[model samples]
Target: MLVTERTLAREIAPAVERSLPGVEVLAVEMLSPSRFCVYVDHPEGVDHALCARVTQLLDDYRASYTIDVSSPGVERPLRKPAHFRAAVGQEVQIRTATPLAGKKRFRGAVVAADERHLRLAAGDEAVDIPYEAIVRGNLIDEGQVQP
Candidate 1:
């Protein structure tokens, strides 16, 4: 997601949490400049269809600002460390904001990942990549989004 949108979500998440108790937001992302995707790891038996409508209602009820919500696309990027861990032994493409070894990109098998950093097995060597350096990372699907 864009910085502005992330800021907005962080500002609104507390309110969302209060209104929708026990609804844990799993992830949020921007699909495009105007589209925002929100994923909630909600409690079972909650009416998702109603929840979606309620979300729309909330956006409409609030006249000052608005947010659009939707599901993750067919392919989703790894947004957390657990996502990285789940991709162990899988090929992945990662991009960083700052250059690492003169570049901001790398692709290799995910060796390990935790809250702190990601370790990628690139050829015979393993490289430790700090989380702050990661711009985005996703499992490499030959026919899917690389990063």
Candidate 2:
């Protein structure tokens, strides 16, 4: 059986932790059948050396897939409850799998997040969106949206 993305992440996480303590693996994205992207972050920030080291350490998987290690950057993707929690009080953009309140897309400041849902304050409205309903979510920098 082919190794799934979650399995790959699980297998490589230990190595990353051993090599760079406090560096967290934020997300693993399969860009294509043969390409993968790994996002990593540290409190001190991620640099070229750290990314290169991560790429080198994951060499065992290189035969089947090309991996690119990267930092989360300014507009980081939010995939889990932990990620959402970190973005609380920050501007965010979310797209749901199905429409909620007559819309599938929402842009606002994240007011709170729990295991099941996140509350976003959009203007005078407060929208509560379930985690299961979210298709994509990312931090939105100031001035990125226009009135």
What are the TM-scores, per candidate, against the unseen true structure?
Answer: 0.63, 0.77
- In model 2, the worst 10-residue window by lDDT is 1-10
Q: Candidate 2: TM-score?
A: 0.77
Q: Note each model's CA RMSD in angstroms.
A: 4.3, 3.4
Clash pairs for candidate 1: none
Scored by TM-score, the top model is 2
Off by over 4 Å in 2: 1-15, 97-104
Residue lDDT tens for model 2, 1-147: 124655676777677878888888876767778888888999999999999989998998999999999999887878689999989999999988789989999999999999999999999999999987876788986767677
Q: After superposition, how far is residue 28 of candidate 2 from its true place, in Å?
A: 1.5
What are the per-residue Cα lDDT tens digits for candidate 1 across 1-147?
457545655755566667777765445555566655555545453365735853764574346434454433334466568778877888888888788777789889988888988898889977888876776776676677444
Candidate achieving the largest lDDT: 2
